[model samples]
Target: MSTLSERDSLFLEIAVGEKLISAQQAKLCKEFSGAVSENLVKNGLLSTEQVASLQQKVEDKLSSGNKVAVAQVEIYKEDTLDEKVVALAKERQLISEEDEKNCRKQLKKLYDLGYNPQLSSILYSAKCISQEDLMALYKEVEPNAKVSIVAKSMPFSELSLPTVPTIGTLKRKTRHEEVQQQESIPSETIHMLDKMEEVVSQISAPEIDIASEIAPLKQEEEVQEEVQEEVEEQPTNESVAPTPVATPMPTATTVTIPNFDKVLEYLENIDYKVTKLQQDQKTALTEALSHEEMEERFDSEDIPDELQRIIKRLRHVSEEEVQVAIRDGVGLENCYIPKMSSSTPIVVKKVNFTNCVIDQVDFAGVQFKNHVDLGNSRFLTKAIFKECHFVKDATFKSCEFLNGADFAKAKFDGKTTYNSSAFRRYVSFNRCGFGKKTVFTRCYFAKGVKFGEVEFTGPASFNDIFIDHRFYMEKCQFKDSSTFSGARFADIADFGRSKFEKETKFIGATFMKWGSFKNCKFSGSANFNTMNVVGDLAFDNSTFESVVNLRAISASRNISLQNIKVGNEAAFKFLDAHIGRLFVSLSSLKGHIDSHIQEDYHVARKEYGLLKNNFREINEYDKEDWAYLMEKRMERMEMKVKGPLSALKRFLNWLALDIACGYGTKPANIFVTSLAMLVFFAVFYFSSGTTEFVPSGELALDHSVKIEQSMSFIDAVQVSFRTFTNASIEGWVPYTDSWLNYVMMFESFFGFFVMTVLVVTFSRKVIR
Candidate 1:
């Protein structure tokens, strides 16, 4: 009894020899437990159905006792056999050791270059061994001597057959009998019989010469003709009974043995044809089942009589007939069209309507299992595909829809593409669902298009698409990344209240009309980089939970970003963006707006300037002041410091314009600075005792009547105020000998400048 492992190994070896599995696959199968076919299926090396078929084949081969022949052929393909052949040939003195070494070196080179050449073939091609010597050596080295020769000599089917007698055997027997009956045999005849015996001995050899062996048969025929003539000349007295004759062997011309290479080629052709036929049958069966299942589903429903008639027509008619009906403007309404193929009607797989002109048709509730192509087709009237399901790739490349088209509530579970298609009238894909990557590249929509409430579970692309009418994609949900790169809108393009859960890009898109993304929500990065808008664009009340890139965006009209919310981790990139007018307020941003532009001063400066101008145009005075202050600050930061003088100028500019008065934008800063300066001077004058009070005489004008006492804080304040106002007080003056007089002049000059700025700012506010 064979062990399970031994049986599995035998089965796998046969499978490998039949090209069902590779030799490496067979080796891998042996490392695992269970039946070889089961292990192969488990490892995904072969399908379950394929393994079952292979098991059947292996069983048949084993029962037929051809396992050894297959196993020996597999061994001959291995490197171990190559080494054995070289060693046995050397042992027999057929090739020297140096030749063997050279052959090994050449074989290694061939192996390095990804070639798996046989050692016998290599030696024969290099003239190191003759064909006869190589074949004899292989026979001796191989475990099954007959397999070593017959495997190469004939096709696999013939090699597996049981041993049988050859035509040469009967010929040899007949020639020997003729020689034995004769008193004397010719020298040529004797030699020919000896050669015939040798040929009969090596009957399995493919190299046997039939032409040389058949020459003796021709001589025997000539001899028989001469004997008949001699017998006729003798003249028999009594009537002779008719003698029965033996059936002559077929001549070489009549029974020609096919060449070994041609036989192998013919066998390979047969195998290929059989495999193709099996695959075709399997496909046809699957398609038939699908059609029957769909028909059963419809039969169970309470549909109308017209719909039932249409369904029956669609099922019974051939694909060409349906195409002809479509071309003839037949209304195929409410029909469940089975999958169609033109060349092989039995295998109804893909449905192709390429370059056809179709009329009005409704394919409601149909399911397409394989590829559905309508490339270069023209739809003359309204086409409806409500609630249809595409189970594989669907293509509508270069199709023209002269009338409107509707695909409401359809489900696409495969890659869907629409390249260079045109819709002249209104089209809708509302409530459709996509399960894989969907593309609409270079499509043109003349009338309005709607994709409301669509669900996309895969990446969607609308690259280079052009819509001359309104485009609506409201309330849609994109679960994966999507792009609209290079798309152009000639009219309003609305994506209001949509949600994008992954990265969304609109790179290099152009909107000639208004574009809206109002109330949208982005859970991932939203890129509008290098976008251009000729009309107003709005993102009112939208939410961005991730990075938003608006780099190099150019809008000729207003861009409204009112009441938008951003996440804390979200960032905005407005690098080199040019907006004619921006409508955003501080209260509009509900979360942290990452507009920290300190890293790039040049961009920061431009961005701040744009904000300032926009705010001023909107007449939001407080926001304008803030934007103006930020602009000046960014400009000062951008200023390059060269020398000490330039550095001092920069610092002074910062102190005066930014810190002191907020670039004349903040009126409160000037008043605060003036009061602060007044207090400082007043404290200095009082603490230093550098001020005196002068009293006037009553009757006459006195030049100076000074009270040489310590000036109080009130007198110090009065003197500082009077000096700052450039007015003289009647009773107080700076002491002549004190160095505070120069301080007073400096304070007055600074006070005058501060007062001038205050007046100018106040006057401007009042005028405005």
Candidate 2:
């Protein structure tokens, strides 16, 4: 063995303390775990007390299930635990060249750790958990393992030979034989009577089992009493007799028919009551009626409640048929016969079109156990079941109506589907409740439809529905926002006249024609932000409770928002497409008055100024281009102003001057001559009368002498010129002279008029 130095012994002790060893690496480094003890015993490096401390630390960590590499332990030898690991690794040469190259890609430079701090921490923490786990992950990349498991055996096995159970065969009558037996029957057929009795028995409450146990004696007594009463009353009605009581038939007993015209007549004559007939009279009557008569009776509005009750009892009877008279103009009562219930779970069912015409249908009061299908059925022209009760699933799939359908106030407790139904005229479902997922997908409306107060308490979908005319859903409440995505309107659709009492959506809906949303009120959020309209979009007086999204829309004509109000942050945002024109009235934009409105006002004013300048510049160009640009400028200017009044006045003034210039007179000469004539006329009109006086000789001589004395050569020449022009010898006028005063008044008036004309002309040309 080589003699060890203090440094080597310390390094081995530290390596053991820090635990930087893998199991394989530990094989090479584990000797260092006790290096401090050995070194102290040999008096080589560390003191015995120091060696003891180091051993305790390493052992404690080992007992705690911690794995330490040799390098990590070595780190404790020279420096504190906070010292860098890479520096220690470099000093010790713990990694081989190939390992160093591989680790370099991940470790790289120290500063590079900041770029992916999360990834670095994950890699470092993973290594600290277990060296084996890190090595396995690295080797996964190197081996390119597919890492899939194959099935070891089959999950199940097939059975061997089986035992078959034997069933007893029974003899049954053939259809021909049964027909022959029915022909031999003479009196009221027992099959018809038995069926009628069964139907009547079936009419009782569903809890008959429990009720029968308590009232079995009472029920028997009541039946006997009813029988006694019927027998006594049977002879009173001369034309009809009661049905004879028959023995109880087996559960599967079949019924055969007999002509029921006489029995029907007897029942009708007695107002649908057969005194001699037992409780089974209902099934018996239906069995006697023919198919044609049954259809006619079912469609008739004149059906009495008692007759309907009998018809319903025999509706399912296989044997004896009944005749139901169906004549036009006859009112049918209780025509919406109650439907049958089965034990099976029905997801979707439809049984429409059984009757061509029905009136006074009372489905509003009945509960359906399963989906009710009513497609392509014609109801009476005024058929109404506005408040029907639906207990289970219901459907009106592809139903067509010739008259108005009133389904207002109906309650649907399950999913309802009305896909492809056509309402030829008005249909009102004002307050119906669709409790489950209701789908009106692809329904067509030829006229106005109202669902004003309908409550949809489910995920209602009107996806791709067609409205040929108007669809109004004012004040409608939806528990969840109903989707009208992909719906198409063929004509003017008015949603503004409707109310969405809750959140409603029309995302991606296509409005192919004109649409009006005037005064439609929303109490909750509405989303029509991404709607696609291929026609005019008008929203007058519409109020939105939440944000209105008109973010991205393509409207062919104008989008008029004359008086609409939105409650929250509006998104007329991100409109980068060509908007034909946006007409937002002043009052409607009140909320934006301080911001967009003010900004737009200033911008409009600036635009008008720029347009005016543009027009002026264009007029200086050649006629053709000037005309075109001027037209464009004028249009832009018109947009910026109330009207074309300012432009018209300027044009008229310029035209008048141009016309005057076209004539022969020089403009300056005409102006000067006109001014001179106006002055002469004013002088003539304002003059007071001229006065003549005789002068004394002395005064005249004095005047001549004074004139001679004042006359210089230039004065004499002026006097001679004045005389040649027939100048009058007029005396100088004083301030108080009448003619001079009149002249001054005329001059003042003329000056005032000239000043007024100048002011008016300047104002017309410059101010406006």
Candidate 3:
């Protein structure tokens, strides 16, 4: 048996202890699992011929095996349990869209275990699902080997067969004949009334069974005798309604008809008792009357509630009346509508105040229950809405404010649209609450817009808006999609410490100063494509439960991202971000931050230094050394200018340090490379046999053919090594000042370089 090397023995023992090899295989190697793997082909346990035969036997044994009831390749399909579970949960109202997303993420981890982990069981433990629902889901993911036999509870009598009525002596109407009679009515003539009549008649006089009724009465007579005995014991007066006497059957001569007016009157009265007639009457009155029809209906004196009366009276106030009321310094109740919820929502057809100039207006605490519109209106001096309430939709589209607008701490209960509106001075919506969707599409802010500490319970938008000064939106909460695409912030814009429940978008945005989004939480994806920033941008300490896309972004200054947490790091991709100075982790930012090291190394070097410190703190000495070495290499490359001497220095640095020893990251590479170089030179010298050795005058023979040709290949190789090593060749030597002698000298110096590189790399690896 061949003796095992010390390293081999150690590796084998570790492998065996870790169960990487089987105990049965150890028996063949004389009682050790790993020795068999290393020495099966090493130790002469069997003859070479027997080994070959045994290998053939093993292949035949494995290939001849079969598994019963195995599904075919074409039939065995992979089922995505996550998609199915998520869809089912949504359909059953068991989870919200956000919760469903979270569950699907959990399901992916379970799928990697080969068997579907009991997610339903986990939900059951959390009281999120019922046992019955869990059991139903369990059937889908149960192993194919576990068979369930479900026995139906119903008997044969419960499943009815198609009825085949027996032939009778009397003539009876067929269903097809009845249907034909009903279809014979003229298409233009409305049969809906006749249908109602038929329905009423059928309900009043249903089909009767004489035998069943007579038998029930006979049983009642017997029950009457028993009741009489009980009546003697205890008597009481309780009246029961008598059953209606059955109508006598008509003879062959009799016929029946009906009056249309009476029937119509009865049906109308029944309909009026319900709300159908009242609603229809109001709708018809609304459509038939002129502009005066609703005026008298909204009279303030007739309304019982004061709030509703005030709201109703506003319908009669014309544009001139409103202007007059404002000019006279009217209170909120006299000018705008009062909020009332007694009836349906009041909708004013039009609130046109276009081209009207408002000198000053303050609606600090007024409430409006109706829709408000001030389209194209101009606010010349001041407009204060510090705590105004809008319980319905409001629009200020195309309106302009010359002085300014203040909406701080305001509340919007419905959609608030500000499309194409212009504010010449500072506007504030700070600490405001938006209970529904709000839009600022194409709006212009000359000074700036502040929205810090605001909470948006619905979707919010700032599409195509222009801001001329600093914009602040720090510590905000967005419960739905929040978009700012195509918007421009002239100065610094901060959205720090914000929480987004749905997708947050900032696509095609431009920033003149810093656009910070630090310490944000995005439950959905954050998309920031095609953004251009002149100054610094930061997204430090942000968490993304979905992918955070930052593609096609440009920044003139530093673009920083550190401590980013993603739900699935492998699924993220950052493309086309031209970083001036990138701050990111190497392990997580592989291939994404690979370039721009030469362009922005001045500022990026500081982050690289920090990365080196981090790696050292983590006890990853190898990575720490690599980080430090790379930082130095970049610094060195930056030190030299782009010229002839610089180019020459770089070329020499690469050849001596990088290729030979991997910039001192690898020590063993030097020895392997040096051996390869020696072998290469030796082969070349032996094969060509061009150089002839000058002989000493010791009665030597002729040198017609090369002397190397007379020597064996090994002897030629020996001669080549001796020449490279500058060893004594005694009587044979290269001609003085010949190319061969020069080549020999170069090889000697090259060997010294190789040795030096080996020593430096080895020392670094050991010390680090």
Candidate 4:
């Protein structure tokens, strides 16, 4: 370690230069140690936030045990650095038997000129070596090399490489050593040399393509050392061979960390960052911006003059290069050359940069005319995709959005898929438009996937979509409906105030941690069959225009149906469902009664009770009392209506009461039925010729009394009215010996019972 005095001198000078400390403060701090001096100077000029940030960085460094970390790389268990170096050099055609002498000399020159001896190591640190590529490289070297991990290796900068001798330069010194070395060399070394030559003579050679993760513009001031200490240098002696290493399995690889603060600053200040253009292009851009009175949407008409110029020059961009294009705070834009020839396909290659740390990448207003595949990619920093238009199919499978991702107002005209992905932080898809089918299958959202006001024009699939933490989809509009089959939620799965226009499906879905669907509107058939919810399923103030099939749901918790408006086609078909409790309103219960969907009696019993009580609380006693009677009626209806005897008895009771007055619940039915019966009986009496009636105070006891006076319709009605009222009147007397006498007797008894029932029912209705 550097001496305290030397450190103090260095730190004090730095503090003074950065204006973080006054000259006098620096002078006073110069007497202390480096760390103490830094603290004192920081306290003198810096705010608490700045001091805390610096302290955090210091703490991280101290905990890491590396004063100046070069690679920020860790050692792997299976593969050693020597093996990787050999593989990379051989694949790059830098080290081979035919050109071994030249390769060594070139390496020596590069090392002497202060260049990193391992450019491949640099790429590895940048997370460029994929698992597939690494395994392939390992297999090729495993046969010839007895690979082993070196124990307690030195730092990368201090490593000593094994020097390879020149075969082309056959000098006196080399020839003498070669003759003696060949005799003393181990058989394994000879075997390895022979295999190396054989590998070169093979039919096909493996290719080594090295590219860093998110090799963006070098617009910052960070010069990182590329040597990786995880890999040890190989043995230099040709006589030694069969060196075995006891290595375990490989685990997570290393990644090169760029200067994060500089990258962040660059991204935040990247206003109007555009591609480099000539004078003519600049003029076209200026003219295009000038023609726009307001910020227009995605059409060529907004920038017609610019677009026409671009039409002449623009070709299809089939390949996107990943390299640093920034220097000295100015973006040296990468040439987006179009590969639009007949020989080249118009589709661009994958925009994949796994484990790459890229800052806010503004892909706004970019139009993908062809397919774009970005699978297994990661954006470690923030990203922006506002107003981006995908004219064709686009895929982003197994990608991660680590930082915030903004995809607001983006348009997808074709199929867009994001399968088995993860979003660690907040993400937005607000106000986005989907012209074709879109999918987000089995994706995990650690934070809320805020997708408010989005319009899905085509079918959207969120099958097995998991909200690992929180979920939000307020006011979203599924214009063509969607499917969320097998979706699992953990915490706060809120989809409040959304709209579904067509068929919505949630087949086999599990809303476990917390479920909410408040104030939503479903204008079509919604299938929630087989959905399992361990939490409350809130649908307060929801509206269903058509059917909502919750047939086989297993909501073990309560479900709220407060103020919900279900259409004529829908009812809670909780046949096999297991709901703990329910919250509903009177109007909603009335709807369920009208719909009369099949449900378990035990499950429905509690809900009916609740409905009745709620109605009473709201001063709707008529409905409450009716529901009470209806509840009992429903129970009776469920009482095994299978056999003929039970059916006959139920039919008799229904005829006696429910058909006419709904079991004393409907007074209108009683009045209408009684009035009709009275008229029919009166007409029957008027048309009959079996009996004659005499207008007297007494009745004739014999059938010999003929019709002295013809009985008219008015006289028959008056007699029928008197019999219905049960009034004693100076009226006609019936012939007791005639068949009409018995009929009149039965009618009088029935009329008395009917009048009594009507009076009691009317009194009950009025009192209640």
Candidate 5:
């Protein structure tokens, strides 16, 4: 074994003194050459953090030159026997981690309240462990463990050293030794031993003189045997059995005790009945006192008769009453709490007020440390929960708020649910913070609800929420994904300037009035699919950093997307939407538009036409033209052809309308087409060998005697221009007898049609 360092010695002393590790474990750790802290952690005696904490304390003592005393270091107290048993049960997977934590918290709470409760009792009270399991665990930890029931009326001082039955020795072994010996004991024998110990431990009497007590019974047994032997020796020869003399009864002073097992059984039954009666009496006393307090408080208040009646029915009539009802399955009913304002906030745990009718109550600045349920309750007046901090799950399911409810600045650190609840008046949750998953599904808000500046650090759901008045969530932040799917807003719903840091969904939602999302930012995909709006819905001045799906949406009025920026990787989908009028700025049209519906030509065409008409209505002619062009392009690209002939025909149609005139939306295209045609004809006429041009004067002379000349490029251009305009080509004419005359005639007809198209396109553009 290595010699212990000063630090190691101090650590060992603290660990053993604090009972963090048994003395035997400490000795074993010291025998090893490794570091003390490392050995403690490796052997599962302490966690690394615990070792570090202890090491810090040791170092502080050394630096200050103060001697370490067990009494001075009271921060780490020893675990009680019940705590060890509960911990062993947890280690053996008999209880969950959450259950263990709850047990510890309850035990601490009881201790703080001046009640010295055992961990086993707390766990049993919480229904986390059963009586059988508790006894089994105790036996595993201490084979000779005894369970002694204490009356509820016993004081803490007396209860601490509960009288141990003198049936056996009460020596306790360290946990390490217990574990080493537990393997050899059969499980059945252990269970029987536990039962025997429990039965024997119930007798709280002092030690008895066993020899004196049994001496009378031993003498009576010997007398009965001697008399029986004498009768048997004389019975054979006599006609009648010798007159049986009754053995003299034991003296009255000599107590004849019953069988030992019978005595134990009788004592156990008496103990059980006494314990039960004590518990019932304690519960009755507590309730009676609580009720009297409530009645006195109620009588002192000069409230109305109707309110008094409601108050009388309430189980938890005051804040003080709430404390007494903290046990499991106890709920407040029809509570009527007055305005409470205190510098020190009240702390409550696991309060349930389900199905109650509560009047105006102010819980401002209160800190709730455990699960709170006010579900299915009716709040008769304005309920204020401002600045309240909920450290565990809070539920308000199916609750009705007749008056407005204010939760402004409240912070929820656990999952919160308000599903199916109704707020008949305006509710304000402004500046609140939700730290875990929050649900407001299937809720009704008669008046507007304000969630302005709230922060949702976890997934938030407002699915199927119905709002009869304006809903304002302005400037709020959703740090995780949020959903408002199937929500119906009968009035204006404004989420202006909010930030959705993850995916947001508004699928199948209805906005009966104006829906504004101006200046908002969607950092993830924004799904507005299958939405319906009766009035204008706008995303003006918003930015989408990812995909924006507006598929299958219907609006009876205008939908606007002005001055918004879409990221490069973002895609905009407006497929199959019933848009009455869209007011989108051209700058906002970034990323892929209608890329998903491109394969369906008809749907794509209809969508583009809607865009075109909307832009035209807004006087955005350039955007209108772009929409129109896309409409035609979709038709050309997605047109189905069954055969070569149909394919040829489709190609011709595209060439004529789209290539030449930009599908009648671009007059500039028409001009370009005409110029290209003129140039091509001029080149053809100049290059063809059979075609020749005659001068105007020569044409007037004899037809046969005219000298033929090849047309120069400039002369070909002049001839083509005049022929295309169908004007009098007085200075040039094709050879009269050659096949070029027919070609020239055909060119004249084509020129006339092209000129008509150009005129129509120009007139339309100018007029529009």
Candidate 6:
């Protein structure tokens, strides 16, 4: 080897600086050059001036007997940098020969900067299958390099990453070095193995269409990463954890928080506050006032200028206080609530409001000054108006409540209407008191709606309210007639322990889900006519003081009436309600009766008696009272029939007397004429014998007895004509005993009757 002369070294350094070589490469190149720097310069590896100056040094170095290395001369070239990196990386045996070749091919396409940290680690770990694969990956991910938003604001607490001490890394390196030294082999042996590997890699390597295979893998991984990014971008409920916040205390505010105190003082100093006064004080004071009223009173102690200044200060303070209070968390109060007038009834005014968004406005204890209009406003935060009084008519049509709304303990003195308000979140009017007519027509309650302990003193109407969640009205009182016609409850509806003092109508209310009236009391007429229910309708332990009308309710499930009571007639005339209870006790006057007799009436009476005897041992009279009452009812009917029978007999007697009085002796005369006609026919039948009689004398006489056939009409006429004068023995045959019996009976019966009838008839005819 030969040493490099100063001039050669200087040229080499300059060339290295100008992309000709590297320092380590210069050392390696000069290690075997043997003073042949001039030859290297002549061969265009070094500068020309460097070669002419280094000829004598080359001779001196050859005379010194040193060897040199030469391949590092091109270390600064693009290809040389890559080759040296590949050779160094291979010397560590960190990757296989095939991987090294493939990686070189991939790294050739990269910018001359360096290898990727991940790709280099992978290659050094011998985990990379091919360099072309890694370069394709680098190209695909290069465009995707971005600052992760998730990691920007992450703190140690949020990151939850495992930590390691600095000493642990040094210890790990030491252990790694020990493992490497144990596996260390001879460099010449490694070189030989590398050569063998190079030959084997060359022989076994398959030509790859990088655009098809490696590029596609990179594209697939990129697509997968994009999908993962999209998934990460999606909003999740778990993304924001609930943090604790301090709650603010409640504050009270008065209406029109007195901002014009100064004006009021000015008016007072000018005697404007004193509009009227007594006659004596007005004449004595003699204060000049505008409008020439009969009298005026003024405090004439020379109105103090200091008082005016103080009033102005008070006015400023009051105004600022109001504004600050509102800024903190105050809502409109008296601006929404107005006083009622005694002469004219309050009527709801029509007003259109648009694009009104109120957030975090606490309306608790707030009132309106005039008839309010909230047409299309939005209350997106907690709204409360507890214990506030409204004196004028108010209308809230098409108002949407997107958050919790509280109107607890609120009182409306005038007509308050909610035509189409939508409560999309939790809404409550718990312990609210309404004094006048309140109407909620076509309102929708989408979440929990609570009216617990609410009291309505006037007529309330909920015409078409749709409650999609739990509707609780526990302990609420309705004094006037309340209507819930065409209303629907989609989920569990509860009116447990609610009181309705007047007529309550639920006409056409559809409870598509379960309805619970666990212990509700209806004092007046309760009409649920035309109600369509799909789920189990429970009215257990409910009381209806007046008529319970279910005129046309259709129920698909079992409508329970266990322990339900009605005071008056319980009408289920046109109901399609499924008969759920086989032992229902619904009476004509009181519906859903709870009498023991009804229970026994439904049960087999005998069976009930046996059960009672076996269990409670009820008295025999108690068991048999029902039977006795039934028998007594039957006996009472029988007694009534007997009395009517006696009256009917008396009526018949009176009718007979009336007939006798109308046709007095005419009936007797007709009777006598009929008797005479009967007697004559009888005598003719006996004397002119057409009748036959046979006597039983002796056997000999019977043989010679005359037998005659009954005569025909012509023969009978001839016989009767002959018998009028003399006896006709051939055609008319009669026995002597038969004639005597007929004539005697006719004479005896008809003689007196005929004579009396003749005398009466003669007397009546003579009198006429």
Superposition error at 436 for model 3 (Å)? 3.2
- Model 6 compared with the native: what TM-score? 0.35
Q: Which candidate tops lDDT?
A: 5
Model 6 segments more than 4 A misplaced: 1-355, 568-583, 586-768
Q: Report the lDDT tens digits of candidate 6 across residue range 1-768.
A: 576664455445444534555666666667665544544555567676655544554344333311111001111123333343445555655456877554444333221221122224224223342334433333333323221111111111100111111110112222112222443423332223222221222222222222221111122233335434543654453222111111110111001111122223333453444334222223212332221121111112322344323222321112333334333333232221111111112222322233344433454555554455556555555566566667666666677776668888877777888878888888888887877898888999988799889888999999899999888888889999899999998888888899999999889998888777778888887788888778777778888666666555776665665687766433323223332221223242222322222332332233223322322222333223333333232333223235878767645433332222212334454554444454455445544443443322212122245544444445444433334323334544335444444543544464445445556645754554
Model 5 misplaced regions, further than 4 Å: 1-316, 326-348, 596-599, 641-643, 689-691, 699-710
Error of 4 at 618 (Å): 8.4
Sort by TM-score, best first.
5, 1, 4, 3, 6, 2
Whole-structure CA lDDT of model 6: 0.47
Question: In candidate 4, what are the lDDT values of residues 1-768, reduced to their tens digit?
Answer: 334443344444444544676788755554654575355746666566654554553444233322121221223324365456556756765444433333334345335323333333333322334323443454454544443222122111111111111111112132113323434534343333222221222213221111121122111122121111222233344211222111111111111221222222332232223333122333423433322211222133423454334333322123233321111111212122221111122223333233222323556666656565556655544567777777777777787766668888888888888889888778888888888898998988877688878888889999999887777788888989699999988777888999998999999998876677889998888888899889889988889877666766887777787788878766654445556655666566565642345555655554455556645655667767766666656665656777899989888777877777677777788888788777877887787633667666445677665555667787777777777666776666567665766767777887887777888888987987
> Which runs of model 2 end up more than 4 angstroms from their true locations?
1-364, 367-383, 398-404, 501-503, 522-525, 529-536, 574-579, 585-768
Clashes of each: 0, 42, 0, 6, 0, 16
lDDT of each: 0.64, 0.44, 0.54, 0.55, 0.67, 0.47
Worst 10 residues of 2 by lDDT: 160-169
lDDT of 1: 0.64
- Judged by lDDT against the true structure, how good is candidate 4? 0.55
Clashing pairs in 3: none
For model 5, give the 10-residue run with minimal summed lDDT: 66-75
Candidate 4: Cα lDDT at 716:
76
Per-residue lDDT tens digits of candidate 3, residues 1-768?
A: 345443333333333433544444433465443444435556643345544544453343233311001000011224454345435766778756654444344344324211133333223322355534533443444323122111111101101110101111012232123323543423221233222322223222222222221111113233334334433443233211111111111111011112223333343433223334334433322222322233233333523354334433333334455544434433222333212111112222323444444445556766656566667665654577777677877778887776678899888888888989999888999888888898999999988889989999989999999999888899999999999999999988999999988988889999998999899888887888888889999988877676566666777676666897655422232355555655655555442232332255543444445456656755667767666766666665566667989888888777667666677677777887777777776775556443544443332333443443333456555655665556665534444534566766787777777777788879867876
Superposition error at 760 for model 4 (Å): 6.2
> How many backbone collisions does model 1 have?
0
RMSD of each: 21.8, 33.3, 33.1, 25.7, 22.7, 32.8
Q: Model 4: how far is 464 from its true place, Å?
A: 2.5
